[model samples]
Target: MSIRHITLAALATLAAAQSASAYELDYSIDLLVPAAWPTSVVLLNVNPSDWASSTRRGAIEDAADAFLLNPSWFFIEPLEDDDSSIGPNNENELTFTSNSALLCGSSACTHLWYSGTDIVEADIYIKNDTYSVGNTKSDNLAYAGSYRSLQTLILHELGHMAGLMDEDGNYSVMGQDWNVLHAGSTDVSPYLDADSGAGLRELYGTRVGFADLSVSHWGYGGSSGGFSTHERNIVEDTSGVEPWHTTIGGEPYYVLGAGEIYRFEATLENKSDTAYTVDVSIVISPDPIITGADTELVRIPGIALSPGPTEVWLPALVPEGTTGLYYIGAIIDAGGDVPEWDETNNGQYLVAAFSW
Candidate 1:
């Protein structure tokens, strides 16, 4: 959210004016009312003529996609029926404004104009004159120690338009401190962060059973004789074990040696309309032995998966002290942040033949 001009004495006057109005929601005061109903899909009209660079338009689309990735009921649709004009008649408009230099410097403003108690339409205005369009180093940066990008600012403002408030005294896109936010530029990948994404999910709805998780490959002790055998769902194969080997989708599991580094490869397929952040973990348990404590070998951090396939690799070393047949399992969404439609299908396990 951006700053506004409000004098100490002006507060009282504004309160009085709001009380006199017939509308239940006073536009003068800041509130958390949504621009549209939860069931309704809102339309946003981007003024294509305003941006000199095409990247800005792509940035706007990317910002919209970010919100759509969340489990929120609020949805945005671009008005493409009439490509000639952005909008001036009915749809909500997102346009550049050069006249709001007093309210903010190179920041964005969202005007939620209401008719009586219902919000008829809202407008998003960007400070095109104060901010650089394509340049990474914005001359008129808003916060002191922050890397403020135009796309990030637009995403924040869009969050506001979708009936979200600033998580003041916290770190989020809605927070006033822009220094904590990140833009998908250079090494940074665009994300809504945890807090903001959770808030949005709470408001709309949650997604469940949205991803298909699988371990594509697993192996220990480099390939023996420069040959590798891989399978999908096998317990153990101990025939002709020659030091080390690799497997590619084989049903029978290959032999794993003690004190050797093993590689686990897995892939996740997002079945939902939006992206997902998944927590992946590998568990090694007594399989052929079936009598020991299950040891969690490693846990990979949350990996962002778009509405498609994403691959991850985890390298783990087997302790030299342990000597037993174990089964390796790959678990997805270990924290349960994502509501899977099918909880039973979240993990895949395979039995392994081991040599100590």
Candidate 2:
């Protein structure tokens, strides 16, 4: 059964607002109902002969495999080839299409058939004639010209099948801009960012037997660019500048002036089925690893974190006359309120150069 559809303009507007956190779940036309696959494992049928070349088929397979890298509870497996069609025939199929109408002037599109909130089928169709599809590792700039990365496109479409909406502004695999797959565009892995993984985990659940509450990283987002955790000086133009001011021995460092406040964001991941009301502490330490023994700068308490990823924007204030090269970091569950499988990963810190 086909559910009602939302207008693209309304969807784009909603996506823009949620871009601060970098992931959105697909909703019905009225935005009243959200949809996701009911099961943890989704099976798809593929035909090797559907592609003109073996590499093309390999690209599709590679895309599906990329999802396995995430900590989400979902799994995608390939079934034996059968006479599959690109419709709501109870078959999830990945194939090519030359129909311009189906493509909608884009390189590819995914159609999902859902009953109420449960997605029963999904069909991914790639425009075989309008674009040249291949592996992105060979050439990421292919999108700049005529070629497109089949793997990247499929990876994004699979996100749709998993009930993730198209994300804008954030550097995500589900980004509307295909150039995000290009090399050197984003610091995070191109296959799946923390945002996408967090979305998946939110939809389904965290993998069984894995309970981790971690500070994924500290970064900032800009109007022109996506979130980044790299080290770079804060300048007038924040377009390409990273969150930290410098880096030492591969560790990020934030240089702060006395009595100055800086705004930054952190990605927190809850790899457990239970939601937690936790506290996040911003601390300063002489050592690279942050701990409760360090000087506490600020404590953000009572953060409601559901399963998956949550992005929080925080302010860091440099105390008067504070001068030293220390580590400025965030410790999730700083009060140890939540029991996790690995407590060591809850803290993530960056070097801080505090100058008077």
Candidate 3:
């Protein structure tokens, strides 16, 4: 997923803050806590009259989708004390100054007063217009927290709630991998990639909560050609080979031939809310005609993927010295059961032939 931010552009939209960062663009953040439960944390959700005009619902929708994608880490709850009365956009206007955490910067983040004294009285904000904060009370999208497939603006704001600032934290959702993390404009939405989602799963999955084991697969017709043929770079789908699903418990049975480059593809859907470690492998079938042993194998790295559609690239993976039919498989590493335990090997698999 590509994270799109727009801080340098908030000017045209009329989003202006009273802080020293009045001219920067927009930015946003996410807070992961685990187990789909939102604690009694407090933060401000401001629209400032023209909010609907300046911000697109889609940006908020994407953020909501992320929260729904993983519920264990976040839950949108109500404010325990709105009675304290903090001014709408002032760094100093406030209550909840005890257990609360503030997300501010530019015009988007007006100010924050927290009640959690230990959180450290530090002032951190999105620094631009393109940034966003959590919705301890944001009711913009009613469809959030239903499923990962759904979207939410609150989650985007929570990222900000969790210090998703300027992309500098070690495991921050606001990290610099995005080109727009700088303090130059007002960006309404930014996205965290599949890899980042996985990282967050690992980071908050344990501390927050775990999810059920689920799976989804999508593939086109045989090598000869069908629905998704062109998408696979499958120049010509073999006429006789029909479509097939890999065994959930069997050892991989795919092969690759010498001098031939193979392209392996698969469609995956994250059935559960937690993150997933999706990977693929190319196995060489040890044949008497082939000189070397099948011992040499090609495996995918720590993919760090989430529960969604992802394509694994295996270019020219097999060396020329070896020639034979092989099986290629996508594996979902052990550990699907609760308590973070490993499960029997479960994944998507396919077979193919490589040639000179």
Candidate 4:
């Protein structure tokens, strides 16, 4: 229990205290949970923060319970791992634990819940609020508005714990801000989709079996009124497909190619007030084919192009005799990075896919 606190705190502090982010997790991810996962996730996390108060503790607990209790998508494990008020280990201040029923790669999966800390929920971290983006400056949170704001915020955070994102969430709860977490700004459901999960896998540098490759469902880009506009609609008008409606229901532009690299000649257009962010990545299916002798996967990653036609491609140069066909497509980054799931169900996110 003690190590949990020390490690996370040290990591959080390390992440927060630093003026510049020395670490950049290629940040890929995988989905241990399936899309619209029907099963419930039990809260085995330990919180050091005094949760006795109805405010913060109740807020978090209610958020966690209410979120998991929801019958909509995935459910939370009913049996919580609240074994100890204080963990056995002094260093593990906050820990994440799960039952054998929900085991993943190893004990690390459950260990995160067993750790000790103020809070521990299923969620990822961005630049530490106190660390990476040093000064705490938020325009939305502090703003004078609705009473549901705090509750919404908690739900959003819990959603991240429940595997949701607002797209780096630039402006929402699931984003770089407050982790900027949100499901989708569009008709977009605020759930992480499959493509995004695959993106996470690629980013994490962990290759999983195609059978293990389950992604969350996401929407396309577009206006609230036109969230469901299909890819065919976006590319139908022109013979070669122009940038018109590229922004789809108008949020979350697709990643045409790997970022910080070749600028894939893809474009989009939309008139929705909702904005979309653009990113690129590659996902390799397990059964990679190599014409030569190398046993490594040899193929191109899928490119997500938002607001329209799904085009799959391959690398121009193959070191030797390596070739294979893989599933490729431009998923709209509606709620998550790769549009696997739309947390808010805002169909405005135009996700189009193609398989090579």
Candidate that would win on TM-score: 2
Q: Rank by lDDT, descending?
A: 2, 1, 3, 4
Clashing pairs counted in every model? 14, 0, 81, 113
Of 1 and 4, the candidate ahead on lDDT is 1
Q: In model 4, what lDDT does residue 165 have?
A: 35
lDDT of 3 by residue, 115-206 (tens): 43212112222322332232211221211211111112233334444333232212122332221110101111233322234434433453
Q: Report the C-alpha lDDT of model 1 over 1-356, residue by residue, as the tens digit.
A: 01111221111111010011110112333356433333447887777674434766766776676556554566666543334343345567777767665225536777665554355566677776433333232321431123445566677777767665554322344554232222111122233433455455555565543333322222211122321121122222123123244542222345676765455544344435467776666677665211113465655555666542344444455557667555666666766677754454355453354555
**Model 1 lDDT vs. the true structure?**
0.47
What would the TM-score be for candidate 4 when compared with the true structure?
Answer: 0.26
Give the deviation of candidate 1 from the true structure as CA RMSD.
Answer: 20.3
What lDDT does candidate 3 reach at residue 211?
41
Model 2: lDDT to the true structure: 0.60
For each candidate in the order shown, give its overall lDDT on alpha carbons: 0.47, 0.60, 0.30, 0.26
RMSD per prediction, one decimal? 20.3, 11.8, 18.7, 20.4
Give stretches of model 1 more than 4 Å off. 1-39, 79-89, 101-106, 115-117, 129-147, 176-185, 207-356
